[model samples]
Target: MTHDLVIRGGTIVDGTGAAPYDGDVAIDGTEIVAVGNVSSNGKREIDATGHIVTPGFIDGHTHLDAQIAWDPMVTPSTQHGVTTVLLGNCGVTFAPCKPEHREKLAGMMETVEDIPKHAIMSGLSWDWDQYGDYLDYIEKSKPAVNVVGLVGHCAIRYYVMGDRAVDELASDEEIEQMAQLVDNAVKAGAIGFSTSRVEGHRIPDGRPVPGTFSSEEELCRFAEIVRDNGGGLMQTVL
Candidate 1:
């Protein structure tokens, strides 16, 4: 049988807890057609002599949400062989933002993650105001890597409480609003939500990010929101 492509004689590490082996891999379009001993000819062939062929890496935590807009390949992460990345980590992200709130979110990401504030501000198109729309924007940009996103509490809190988010616990109504926003994000495409409680992760004014001082009741409310959504990843930094 003829295949679309074949890689011959590479050391294969397939990431299945299997031992390394020298073999041939044949591909038909996007799918792997054969492995081990592929005797069929291919439309294109690569001599993988003295090389390694392995599955692409997955990075579960990355802050490439802003960078993806300007750098579709997402830079160093892709250079290191990662093909999939999870964005909106560490309770910092650029969505669920009001137009007036864009600068605040950008500044907070810079404070905690050291991403350049100017780059974030100027680089992105700033088209979306919600987490799901942010994801849609990411897709529209056509990044080289597959992207997964987690809705972030910092953005949620800021969107709801503005500057007071850093210092005050959310009001009952604010918490409910936050829950509704998170539910909308998940329904749109978010796999989960994230927040930070560690003292070190603070915004530009040296205040802790919004979720850092969350009361148990507040945390439980968020948990319930995700639970009712059939469960989702809750990434909290502590």
Candidate 2:
């Protein structure tokens, strides 16, 4: 039986905390079939004589929420061998938005992330209104690598409170609603929830992001939701 592809004579770093070793890797179809000295010849062969072969990297923090709208390849990350990227970081995302609030959210992202608003506005279809719908849109975008998303607190707060999300503390009822939204997002396949408290993370108007001033109770409620949902990550940029 012949293999589909073989990479020969490379230092393999398996990323398992195992020691690196010089070996050959054989691939049959999409699955890696074998490693080490493989006697079988492959349909395609690559001479990786002095190179290092390892699993693709996973970037834990990224702001590709807007960029991915236009560029499915996601640029430099893919070029550098990052196979997975976590988006919606620094508590900024574009989802759960109303038609009327589209520009507001886009402008917020533009201000905080420095991604051009025109590109975001023009490139994306804007067909989604929920976290799951956004995921579906991304799935159809055929990204070059795997994309994991987090529910951004900024977007969620803005969606639920409009202008008040910027300055006023959320009410008890509002906190409950926000908690439910976070729960829904996690169930909808969001890898986690993200928020920012760093003073540097602010919109162009000099106001901090929506979730920056959340009370401890609000934060804990969100954490409880994450814990109850089996397990998930929480990203905070402070």
Candidate 3:
């Protein structure tokens, strides 16, 4: 059978963090059909001699949540060969937000990530109000690279507890509610929960983020939820 594409004579740096080797890789449609001495008649061929062929890299940290709505390639990261990115760090995210909270979230991102609020405001589409809905919205987008996201504690807190999440400690009842929200997000495909307490992140109103004042008990409870879920990573800036 004829292959759809063939990469001939390349140094394949298979991303095992190991050394490189010379080989040929073959592709059938979107999947890599074969590797090593791939003898195939192909419609397209790449002369990859002296070039490196490896699995795409992932950016562990990036604030491309808003930018991905407008620019899916993520610019410099893509240029540098990052094919995947994880967003929603330092306790900020655009997901699980109401339309009325667009500016509020944008301001938080701008202040925490140094991205301009106008840039976020001009670029993003605030059309989703739940974590799952937000993921669906972005999935429909034409992304040049794959994107995975975390549910930010600040956003979840804001969505659940509203304005009170910032100034007040979460009551026992509120903490349980927040835990449920996080649980829902994880089941819906959020990678995990992220929160910030670095004293550096402040909202436009000059207030620390909601999770900044979150007690150790609150954060530990969220972490427990993540651990129980079988797949979640907590990112805290403290």
Candidate 4:
């Protein structure tokens, strides 16, 4: 049977963190059907003689959450051969935010991540208010690379506790509410939870990010949500 594409005569670096090998790659539709001496017929072929072919790299730390809405391909990262990217790092994200809190989130991102507030404000569509809706927006956005998200602690706190999240510890009731929000985000396809306890992360108003003030109990409660989910991980900067 004829294949969709064939990449012939190249050094294949099979992403096992091992050494490279000389070979050819065969592709059918979206999958790499073969990676060795591929002698199959194909509709199209790329002459990769003397070139190197490797599985696409993944960027584990990316802040394109806001940028993705406007630049789905994620530009420079994709241009540099990163075919997958993980976003929502340093406890910043745009989901789980109310309309009134949009600027707050933008300001936090600007101050902490050094992403310009005007860029986020002008670029993001801001049509979604829930974590699940944010995922849906990303799916419909059709980014060139695969994108995975982590539920941001700051976003969760801001969503459930509003302004009080910045400097105060959650009460029993608030902790439970925050836990539920994180659980929901994990179930909705977040790969994990992220937070920043670093003193440098603050809002433009000079208040530390809500996650920075979160008690250990609050953090552990959210971590439990990820642990129970069976495949999530925790990423934080303390």
Candidate 5:
């Protein structure tokens, strides 16, 4: 039977901890119909001899939250066959932001990450102010890769404590508010939460990112939030 396409004569690494083998892959539209000695003729074909064919890669940690606004294809990683990326790593994300606070968050991302502050400020649509809305906006952008987001500590801390997030440990009241943010984010399809404790990841004014100075109690509160929300990942940069 005819198929949509076929890749013939390649070494296949199926990614199930299995050994590689030479094979032909039959395809129907976007779905792989068959593997191994696929005898079906295709409407199109490629001679893949000497090439390696494998399932696309997943990049587990990325900061593509800002970059996705301007570049939906999410290049470089896509060029390297990465089909999915986890964003909002290292506790720096742009959501849960107040309109007046956009510049500060962009500047902080620039200092901690190498992205240009101007680019982040100008390139994004700034359409969302909370974690759920942020995800919804990126969805409207029609990204080329699957995106899994982590709600970040910086945004939650800044949202709850404002500028004091950089230097002050959260008060009991502030921690409670931050807890609600995590719950909101996780319920909105955030796959996890991210935070940082390293001395180096600071904002523009020489202060470490918002979560950097948090007390153990505050950090644990956020973790417990993720845990109680049916349990998810805790990605930390130490």
Candidate 6:
């Protein structure tokens, strides 16, 4: 039977630690129907000779949050064959924020990642306030590749403590609130929580990012939330 499409004459490295082999890949509609020297003719054919085909790569850590706002194609990453990316690394994301504090997150990202503030401001609509809402926005943006996000502790701290987050330790009540927010974000769509402890991760104003000063107890409390929520990843840039 004929296939919808065929990629002919390529070295296939399936990424399963298997050895590479010269083969043809046949596709029917969107699914790969066969591989390895398929003899079937196809409606469309690509001469993949002299090329190696492999699975798309995944980037474990990325600061694509601000960049994704402007570039949904998630360029450079996509150009390099990275089809999946994790965003909101190093505790800088724009979600679970008050309308008044939108710029705060932007400034932190701008400072820590060197992303232009104006690009973030003009890129996309800041129409989300909850972590889930931001994920929904990502879905609607129709990025070229899959994206999983981590709820950033910097934005969460700023959301919970306002200006006090920069220098003040979280009170017990505040910690509980932040933990609950993390739980909410995880349930909403976040794959995990992220924070930064490195001195270099400063906000636009020269102060360390919020959560940088958090005590170990505070961090454990947040970790406990991830544990209690069944299971979710925790990312840090220390």
Candidate 5 per-residue C-alpha lDDT over 112-209 given as tens digits, one digit per residue, 9 for 90 to 100: 88899999999988878789999999999899999999998999888888889899878899899999999999999898899999889999889788
Candidate 6: which pairs clash? none
Candidate 6 per-residue lDDT over residues 126-163, each given as its tens digit: 99889999999888878999899999998889889999
After superposing candidate 3 on the true structure, give the runs of residues whose Cα lies further than 4 Å from its correct spot: none
Give the residue spans of candidate 1 off by over 4 A. Answer: none
Cα lDDT computed for each candidate against the true fold:
0.90, 0.88, 0.86, 0.89, 0.90, 0.88
For 108-198, candidate 2 gives per-residue lDDT tens digits of 8888888888888888888988899999999998999999999989888988888899898999999998888898889999988889998
- What TM-score should be assigned to candidate 6? 0.94
Specify the poorest-scoring 10-residue window by lDDT in model 1. Answer: 218-227
User: Could you tell me every candidate's TM-score relative to the true structure?
Assistant: 0.96, 0.96, 0.93, 0.96, 0.96, 0.94
User: Which residue pairs collide in model 5, if any?
Assistant: none
Residue 211 CA displacement from its true place in model 3, Å = 0.5
Q: What is the lDDT of residue 16 in candidate 4?
A: 89
What is the lDDT for 147 in model 2? 92
TM-score of decoy 1: 0.96
Question: RMSD, model 5, all Cα superposed?
Answer: 1.2
lDDT of 4 by residue, 1-238 (tens): 7789999889999988888888888898899999989878779999998998999999999899988888888899988889999989989989888998999999899899899999998887788877988999888889999999998989999988888989888998999998898888889899999999898888998878987977889988988889999968799888
